[model samples]
Target chain A: MLSKSAARAFFLSGTLLFGAVFIWLTVDTFQRIPAQTNAGDLNESVVRGKHIWEENNCMGCHTLLGEGAYYAPELTRVYDRRGPAFIAAMLKDPEAVYPGQRRMVKYDFNEEQISDMIAFFEWIGRMDLNGFPPEPTIGMAAAAIAIPGGERPQVFTQICTACHSLGGVGGTIGPALDGVGDRFDRGYLMRWITDPQAVKPGTQMPKLELTEEQRNEVVIFLSKQREAGL
Target chain B: MKYQSQKVAYWFFATCMLLLSLQLIMAFAHSGFDVLHPWIPFNVARASHNNLLVMWLLAGFMGAAYFIIPDECERPLYWPRLAYVQLIALVVVGVTAIIGFHFGWWEGRKFLEIPRPLDYLVVVDVLLFVANIGMTIWKAPKMTTTSIVLFFGLLMAALLYLPGMIPTDHQTHDAFWRWWVVHLWVEGVWELIMGAILAYLLIRLTGVDREIVEKWLYVIVGFTFLSGILGTGHHYYFIGTPSYWLWIGGIFSALEPLAFLGMAIYGVALAKKGGRNHPNRMALFWTVGCCIMSFVGAGLLGFAHTLPQVNLFTHGTLVTAMHGHMAFWGAYAMLVLAIMTYALPLLTGRKLFDTPSASYAFWSTNIGMVCMTVAFGVAGVAQVYLERRAGMEFLDVQRELKVHFIGLILAASLFTSGIIAFIYNFIRYGLPVGEVEESVSAGAAAAAPAE
Candidate 1:
């Protein structure tokens, strides 16, 4: 067996050297992030939001800074994709936003708490993470869709693409609209877009409730869509 | 059993098995695959699963120490009844923590999820265990290299738990200290415990000289400390820690495998050099199997993502789950089973090592775990590519990977079957009885080949 002294010497030096390196690393870690960027400010909204995040145990499903469960999407860049308003809307009524998912157990948070959650996500969005959770490809194509009126793309961007994909560039909650013009006539488009549940009961799509003029305008725009290269 | 107090170790091992079964059950609930309690939900189930795992392994370590220390010191236990009190306290704290997780009364930290109040309770329980083991060695007429090393490992583990309790509000700061408990325990002091246990087993099973086996133990300890301590940097990288850790963590953690490699070499060399004469060949299989498999799991698989470049993609993914299952199974779980395999025969005066079920338990568990690792590997790789690389939404990737859990569930069932068989054999042995026979002790001395 190793003599008692030799064993002790080995243990001591190894531990000392290792501890020295660890301390150096810890010091470097503390100094790495600038004061403004790290999660230390504890501003009223940020502090409250942090508590809400912990109290609700949001990390149980959603990952923040890639440290939580992988069952939900990485929320490190959530503020960028879904803006604060959309996040607020989703938090207010999650079942209305997207349905039939066991993940993201929605709790009843009031307006202030929702605002705090938004502030927390906004803060995380600002952290200097080195190119984590690579940016999404959808809606990032730079070329805005051609439209007959300015209101058409605005309506599509604001409401429609939350559930529908167009030209293979949106959420997958609803069907893609690349060939909608060929598939449906103006009358059919008007009926479907204005009151979806009237035509297909149990459809997740809620009524758009557009004016008659606006309905006709949306129909014209949607009916004009052909296959991308056709 | 050699000492009357050694019977206490049986109840502790039984607790380990019961808790392990609970962990498995909670794993299903966490995945929402449970029909019984679909409402158990992810947060509570995840906490229970992870916490139960740590608790059971702690129980196993305590049992292993109780069984080995008296024999190595060549004396009866220092305080026999005190061990029972410690075990009961450990279980009470564990159950309360599990119940607390359900009510959302936990500190939300991964691994160290028990709230601050329970954290204090856990500390008290550990102190009791440490003091009991400490006094045992103090009062022993003789102390072997094995007992002293085990004592140091336990004591250091108790000291290290304090760092996790360091209060911090900063997320980065909290994560930094949390790892001081998690990483240091698994890769640092636990290796010492494993080394000491392996040393004790080799000395007894291999009929090798205690001197020869323990000299190798020194080398293993040197390797573990040299690499494991600095290797904490690996977790520091990209958790809002220093950019410098990318280099430091990568370099040091890469060297961590050498320690496991040394253990594998030490185990195989001792087994080969010592004549193939131990009657309980199953124990030898588990001992050598633990060494080799830990090299693959903790050494090779851990090295797979230790580098910052790879960890950026693979951290917190199922790839981690892959490494975790194999490494914990190979290193700690098999080490416990190895001791039980060796001790069970002596503890209960039954030699079931040569039975068909005994060999089946060893092969089936190892094979089942390997298959489970492969399934996790495939899912993790696909997740990294789709979610991280292609920038697919998180829930989308999970949907695609749902099919992979089918493979995981099937493999886990096979793994559970093996564990059941092992536990059945343990039960059939029908508890500790009788004294250590004279002939066995005489044979142990006479068969010391190197001496």
Candidate 2:
């Protein structure tokens, strides 16, 4: 038999108590956020990049820090996952990166803007987000098929894996590279890695912007992908 | 209607219907309708969709307040003209913001995408609304619990808008404060508004004793803030906030359902206890329906993911949408509709209640929304498995989820039909031109045996 006065007291006291606690926690959170999110990394470029992010309403499609529209991929860890080259290239032309898939509105950002965006994402990726974007626990075991190559090169991981699969651990857009070394020679691998369009007139793979050394590295790595043991 | 000033609420409800239609169209375009993609891109459509939902709901709340305050206070509004001016200003600001969103003239935040200049205008318009309502209550011969609770909710909602406008360069800090406006309004003060409105409706429609209804009102809203204030922690868990938030958010948010459950029980029990059948049976259906659905939608479904463990996967996925669509539809959307249905007949002197279309509107919208939630849930769960658990590529998973969006579209079409029926009923009722009748309260009249 709760009376109205008692109910009113319950509401007033509970709200004030919890509201105060929330404000105190907010203050404490602000204190810790500087270190947790690396507030010092809030450089001019990153700030400008944030402005670009908001100005373009990127969150309308993509998510950051596990907030925003779910139409696009979560981009909080994009810098770490894709690396600068891939992000820069993708920003330059989104459809070219993921052809015939979900379309991204191309902003035609200049080099400086691209770099700024990269920096912003880099800063975001480093934050301690209570272990968000959790590691894919169930699929990682199946995807970790042993590659014939001793060790995959950085160029292959950062650029080639975006479209192509290596030991079933990457994208499905391109053919699997499990026995690629057995199929193609070093010369062809080198040429194809340098420019897929040149090797095949109408290949879906764009001519990846890679340095000579990175191209060689990718070619060597692909050439080692033998069906048999390395 | 007892007061001439109550007529102003009709215009606000009309605006609501208009905005709601526009919102549905934008939502369809945003959900991969190819023909409108180039004309209304995803961002444009999304910003408009979210903004329009907020705008229309605000209008509904304002309308509900205008209609209920005069009836409760036993006096006419202090400045009825100002209510009209406020509505016009709000519509103008809303139209400008929606147009600006298309041209990339926006702040670009989700739910707060109205441009900075328009944000100021919105604040001014809301202030005018608050002042008008406040003055009405101030000059009233007597004050009721419902009027006071409703007024406080509106005032606090206006104040909460400021936190989102706080300037921030750091993304984490930005998110932390943005939730102050979004979370606090929906979960916190808005519940106060919902509670008060439900109290008013239950009092009038069910012919329940005002003492009994208002007493429970305090308890329900008491439970609301008791849990909801700390429930803001749930948003903080993964937004670069501290680890402590995980425990705080998980524990408190788990309790959030109790408040909603109370609401459901309150509505059902009062309807049974009153034992008086009002002529406006449709209004009672909506009122009771809002309560039950809010529990299932906001209370139970929200609990399904509020935990830190499950949320670790479902965060930023379509799962949130599953909960969100029904929660808003149940808690806020239906609350507004309940009040609209209750007030419409009295406002226009139309006996359109209990019509077949009215019942069809109720059933179709509820069933359609539930189906939509199921579609979102299926897509979302599949997405979590493929993308989060299995680490499939984002696009690969999205391609897989396309079929669910088709299901969503189907459900949305049914929901839209219900809305059309509701709007048709509204139009048939015509305008709020009913004469001011000197009579007993609606509850007392309903309680007496029908003549």
Best candidate (score: DockQ): 2
lDDT of 1 at B366: 93
Stretches of candidate 1 off by over 4 Å are A1-8, A34-36, A89-93, A135-164, A169-171, A179-201, A206-230, B32-38, B434-450
Q: What are the per-residue Cα lDDT tens digits for candidate 2 across B68-157?
A: 898888788899889999999999999998989889999878899998988999999998999988999999998989899999999999
Q: TM-scores of the models, in the given order?
A: 0.89, 0.97
Question: After best superposition, candidate 1 residue B400: deviation in angstroms?
Answer: 2.0
Q: Which ten residues in a row have the lowest lDDT in candidate 1 chain B?
A: B30-39
- lDDT at B284 for candidate 2? 92
lDDT of 1 by residue, B188-218 (tens): 9999899999998998888888877777787
**For model 2, how does the per-residue alpha-carbon lDDT over A91-167 read when each residue is reduced to its tens digit?**
99987888877778888799999999999999999999999989998878975667766677777777777777765
List candidate 2 segments past 4 Å from native: B33-35, B437-451
